[model samples]
Target: MADKMLQGKVAVVGAGAKNLGGLISRTLGADGASIVVHYHSASTKTPADETVRAVEASGGKAFAMQGDLTKVEHVVKLFDETIKRYGRLDIAVNTVGKVLKKPFIETTEKDYDEMFAINAKAAYFFIQEAGKRMNEGGKIITILTSLLAAFTGLYSTYAGSKASVEHFTRAAAKEFGPRGISVTSVAPGPMDTPFFYPAESPEAVAYHKSQSMNGKLTDISDIVPIVKFLATDGWWITGQTIFANGGYTTR
Candidate 1:
């Protein structure tokens, strides 16, 4: 087994069913931190079960917790449950987001509202609630999108949502600095996950691949190290979003 990087620590990962969240859960769990697998209804699947099993097998601890991050009460309840079970929250990594794939002309007010509710609003409230309950030296990592910088057309709403989270991450970091809580965001490029392939067009996918220095989608394996570093070893790092793209647009 690997060294216990975060032995006896507790981490709550929002949207930790599969893909990025699952990977984050497993990575932290493997490092010796107990995990809270928070998932939304749409993400309900065996991924949660599988993640819990994987964590336990790796000499870590984990439990599955479901809640709608869009609601403030749910966010409070989630932290409450985590503290009740694990005693205190040492880390929190939020990987939940609302992605709207509609064209600009097709976008509506409802779409804007829903997107913010999930991406910005929920994240905002989650940080608010979690920040209040977190102990000193706690870590908070939020997952945003590199699209905020690229602004690839046809994703106005999606970009806006991610941009908001990026801003929130920075602002929260500054606010939580005095408390010894570090807030950071992970802005990843196109990753080889269900969230990327199903929603993107062939042309778009090819275009993104061509933009990369390696000409490929971001691998979940490659992302694990960045997450692990920020979640555990990055005590001095805060208020910055680390881009985990495979040389996709240096900007």
Candidate 2:
């Protein structure tokens, strides 16, 4: 691949300050893209700030923007900040998500609503607002989950949230195809992040590991390259969910 495959591009990675989001931001920055690192909270500096540091360290340009993605106004503000700082918006990777774990019966309306607000509704508007500012050949990628297909117990709301994102990718791709913007989702299973620590329980941990073909956990680093690929190289592909789950799905 060319060293500058993403040169001169501007990207916004929401929730970019910690864990997988931070890693994805750094990887894209390393590939020569200028970045807008978006975080949700104000109390603490987000992982996106650290991402900016890493990007500058690697000789790329980046700055930090903060907003609540759950609200349309804030989502719009995120992009506005990006454009104000960078002059253009080219790629928006929606990596903001939360999982509310409980059995379907125990799940509350509030849980469903909150998950949808952050995981689904946020991405939809993020793309909408960013799309308005994005130039030709722009890209939008969202982090999805194999759980939507696996539909395991204890994640009814979570799975529904991700399933919404998967379908949104398809719809957005079609809606934006004429303008040359690509929309896609990358779904992974059993990733090694702070999000997966319930696996510390011996029985549940064993079961989770067993689901992988290799009986191992997928590292955050393992997923960054694929996220980078979908954001840049796989331009012709859109509306599809590429599962990066260590062979967690064979069908």
- What C-alpha lDDT values do all the predictions have? 0.85, 0.82
User: In terms of TM-score, how similar is model 2 to the real structure?
Assistant: 0.93
Quality of model 2 by C-alpha lDDT: 0.82
What C-alpha lDDT, on a 0 to 100 scale, does residue 104 get in candidate 1?
86
Task: Give me candidate 1's TM-score against the actual structure.
Answer: 0.94
Predicted candidate 1 versus true structure: per-residue lDDT over 49-83, tens digit per residue = 88999999999999998899999899999999999
Clashing pairs in 1: none
TM-score against native, each model: 0.94, 0.93
Candidate 1, which segments miss by more than 4 Å at Cα? 1-4
Q: Model 2: which ten-residue window has the lowest total lDDT?
A: 1-10
